[model samples]
Target: MLNKKIVEKKLTSKTYTPKVLKELYKIFNLRTKQEKQKLRKILLELISEGKIYKDSKGKYRPLKDNLAIGTLELTRNGTLAFVWTESGDEIAIPAEKLGNALHKDKVLVEIIGKWYDLPEGKVIKVIERGLKKIVGTFQPRGRFAFIIPDDPKIQYDFYVPVEYFNNAKPGVKVVAEIVKYPSPTRNPVAKVIEVLGYSDDPSTDFPTIVVKHDLPVEFPEKVLKEVAKIPEKVTPKDLKGRRDFRNEIIVTIDGADAKDFDDAVNVKKLQNGNYLLGVHIADVSYYVKEGTELDKEAFKRGTSVYLVDRVIPMLPFKLSHGICSLVQGEDRLVMSLLMELNKEGEVVDFEVTPGVIRSYRRLIYDDVNALFSGDKEAYRKIGDLKEQLFLMKELKDILRNARRKRGAILDIEGGEVKIILDEKGHTIDIIPRYRGEAEVIIEEFMIKANETIAEIFNNFDLPFVYRVHEQPDPDTILQLKNYLSALGINFKLPKKIQPKLLQELLEKTEGHPLRSSIERLLVRSMKRAVYSSTNIGHFGLASYAYTHFTSPIRRYPDLVVHRLIRNFLKTNGKLTKKKIKELNKKLTKIAVHSSKRERTADEAEWDYTALKKIDYISRHIGDVFDVVVTSVTKFGLFVEIIDKYISGLIHVSTMNDYYIYNEEKSILIGERKGKIYKIGDKLKAKVIKADKTRMQIDFEIYNEEENKSNIN
Candidate 1:
């Protein structure tokens, strides 16, 4: 009874709470504090028994307060903020009080404030740390070294002792891990795990980024060995219990550089004048079963990442590029969804079957577009498949109409800066790539397949991972409307706003100076697409049901769908209640992971592209061009150069003439001269300077009347 009271007193006391004592015990085990304090600081986080708390001044007070658990999101300034799971409220902790907290650490954060605005916290216990490896450039600093993180979000440079360098030098990029980060230390101590080579090494840098982000570079040795042991040729076992479609003249339509094909199409005009369209997806589940090493690896990867120059696939190359890839002239396993559609594009009849089929040809987008447009050269190349090609075009248009009518967000084909590389993988030129009708046709076909499969699960009353996008919040929409109105654009607010209204606004803004900017705003207003087990429907597709079921080769959710469909189809035709519940939970977790990975990949890709574009423009410094006013603020007018397509600021003081900014109109009006510079107006400008490192371009308006005589 005395011991219990002592323990209770310790838990509620101001110093060394029960949680902290447990953590201290774990760190020390059976030793004293003097002995444990000498060890590295990072290893201290391994003692996850403590709670985090907040002091009076919005600062962390570790060991002094009870731990409150929350997920940590660290800022570049080294401050920690986390959302409390119980209240859905966020609190900030200053860097000084954070102790050894790292970004993405889940810790017990003790709340201190009654109000939301000034809430403070201290981390009581660290539930988890982001165990993901980090990539950075290492620099030797006398006796110790520090690594400048590649990810700008990672606020702190890791402190490394000279002994831990493993012979790595300054200016070299490397992968490393935090060894210790004690409360008293200014920087986290780390050890170089791998030297990835110099910054100029493109291949190594790209792959290192891939690895550092926890993206799989290659298949696991065991998985690769397993794939190799599988028979190369189609056998009787592979053909057993499958529908045969060997005689069908099916073909795959993909990008010119596409290697792994997951979908093939066959559309024919039936006797009733309705179309019979076959959407055959490669049955990867047949080879990669659940609970296997391959399945585990695929689940971990979540989805394939496609960068400008390369692809980081979820599965091993042998399976993703070989066995499961829908290559031409090869019999492959498939989960077939054959639908009979009338001229109105309504499904008349449908059949789902496990099947085996052979692809007749691999048709690239350019050749297909030429063939569809009656190009004789394309016909001369593949004259025999004319009838099938015509059917595909018609079917694709029907599906497109169905999608657009259902209120799918339609985006204009944006310019893609393709980084053309030479033999040594050095950037040669960055050319813009346009999307053609062929690409749209493939997209329409894939959407149809995805929707059809989603409907199949809905009919079976099975829980599945859905690709969902919720409607924009009313506040966000109102804000967007106000932004548009301020830009001198009349975007009328609907009584009840719909996706169609936003789409119409985008359409109206086409060819305007603010087209891309406005489109980006609208996209930003909309909720990010995410994976969810809950059947809320897809707001983007305007569908009552939606799931990613067509891209199993690249996406793990699709694989789950494949497994679920096959399990139910091949078994007694009903999923057990328990199994369904378990799948729901599992898929929900997968949805979160897949969504996170998608966002991470997007950020990385955007960073890389933006860097390259800025670097390219830096070459032609001080060049003038026509500029468009994107935004007019009280301080300055944000302008985008026409030829370079880069943004820069023109400060108010640099306007030369006395001007007053019209806040409501989002325009700048010269008071004395009465000259107006608005959001969409074109202006002549001279490139004053370019800062490549900061990605800033300085411009001075041409001031035609005043500066014309002196400039030339």
Candidate 2:
């Protein structure tokens, strides 16, 4: 017979099974009878409170809670409650009370206290309902049907009736509106609003995402009719009360596929050896007046959504892509910003004007970059303005250097993946999109314009929308410092880490193997930039004052800036005091909604693109490729395959090497073998399985190469 004390040590030592120290005495024969009896009573009481559960046979497990009220983030296995307290302390809910709550559903929860290693929360009541519809594949069972959501995080399938199928056939992809959510036994009931088609249908996913997010893809009849009443060309009377830039010889720069041109640039040398540069933005507010159908619709949409293949414009096509596009050879309404800068790129004086302009040419980024870089073909198109173009290039370089010194985060080494398409609209291959000198020229000019406008409002003590980003949390910065400290990367940290410090770190990491991985971590620790009436400084741009004064045709904040500038200019620099109070209140509400919608749209688009990328890679299984571990969890290692540009999972169990998770360090280390596989380490992996339906990929390390070639 085995002694009870020996049995307890065996269980604890072999499996590290979690147990309350007091409870263990109840099951084991202690020398003191009184201690045993007391432990039994306490253990029984804990069991009665339902704060713990026993396994199928008889092993006790803690019931996780630690209560909270938070938005639910549902996952395939369970759900996590994301709670933000009044003091801004963020905590995650335990796996138990996730219940039937889906993503973004606000709910109240009861905290059950902490388990061995994780905080636990249990759902009590749903505080708010999510109105967004789910896109999925329709599964029909005789007269009944259900939609298995495309997002795995949506734990429950939506139930549907035969009549609510909306002409959708079995196994077809569709959009279902949830009518009823799940309780104990039942699933969510739904009504079908759209039948997309077979999962393999060409370009079906694009429109599906647009509709799922309730994005406006078409114009309302009234809005279209209103735009039709506007004149096609600028009239003489239209030039009234506007600065005329007709002789500026400005040109619009965009992509070859771009149709709606919202910005134009002009540069000239001043007599004092200073440069006079103008950034003229299309004055959409001048055409689409307030309280009209066109304005209302645009306000509701907030901003245009640009997906991979299509765009959902805020206004009708007649206005967005035609009347106010700043098209070449056509006079257009503009709000212009003129700046006088010394040869060293320091702004001496700046002026904002409500203006009318004619775009002398519509140049693409690639063409302009090539011409600026001394390509003969590009120079031929520029004709006699070569000297002016050369001076603009010098100014751009100076301005770029100034921004770097000011801690502005520039797009220097990052690359964008662009999908090339065939004539029939099918994807051909993935190509890298590069931003050359021309792109930087526009970006530098736009940043300066935004800063100038922000300063204008600041100096006047006027209310306005400012794009702001606060410094990273002290705790997050400390965590990051500790994380990099272990890797021997040291840097100076102020009482609080500023954007300039972050930018400096980024610059230091450029071209390193760990650049992308480390930059991602840094960015993840920072809050997103947003528009606000509050004048908090922007941390990302390292700017004390920043506003969206460049893209008025697309961003609502820019439109507000346009209106504010017009009001101020109309009164001859005397700030309008009467209407700004009311306008500021309205703009605040607009800013909140616009930011929320923008985040939602960004999430949906990224998910859609990831899905497509996974699908494309699913067709090429058994292919061997080099990969980098992008993320690590208890369950698996996520690796991004270089050849396909798709990320997949490598279950930790398949590492086939003895590994130990160092939780405190957020790393996984191997035992016995000194082989270290950390985040950003390059490894060759062969695809073992690819599931398009689940958007999952499985990989195994290519061990054969280990013996033949030295990985390190």
Winning model by TM-score: 1
* Candidate 2 residue-wise lDDT, 40-118, digit = tens: 5654544433334344345554544443444555544554545432112345666566666666675556666664344
Clashes of 2: 9
Q: What's each prediction's TM-score?
A: 0.81, 0.80
How accurate locally is residue 146 in candidate 2, as Cα lDDT from 0 to 100? Answer: 81
Candidate 2: global Cα-lDDT? Answer: 0.72
Instruction: Go through the candidates in order and give each one's C-alpha lDDT.
Output: 0.72, 0.72
lDDT of 1 by residue, 602-622 (tens): 765665565455545555556
Q: After superposition, how far is residue 541 of candidate 1 from its true place, in Å?
A: 0.9
Q: What total of clashing residue pairs does each candidate reach? A: 20, 9
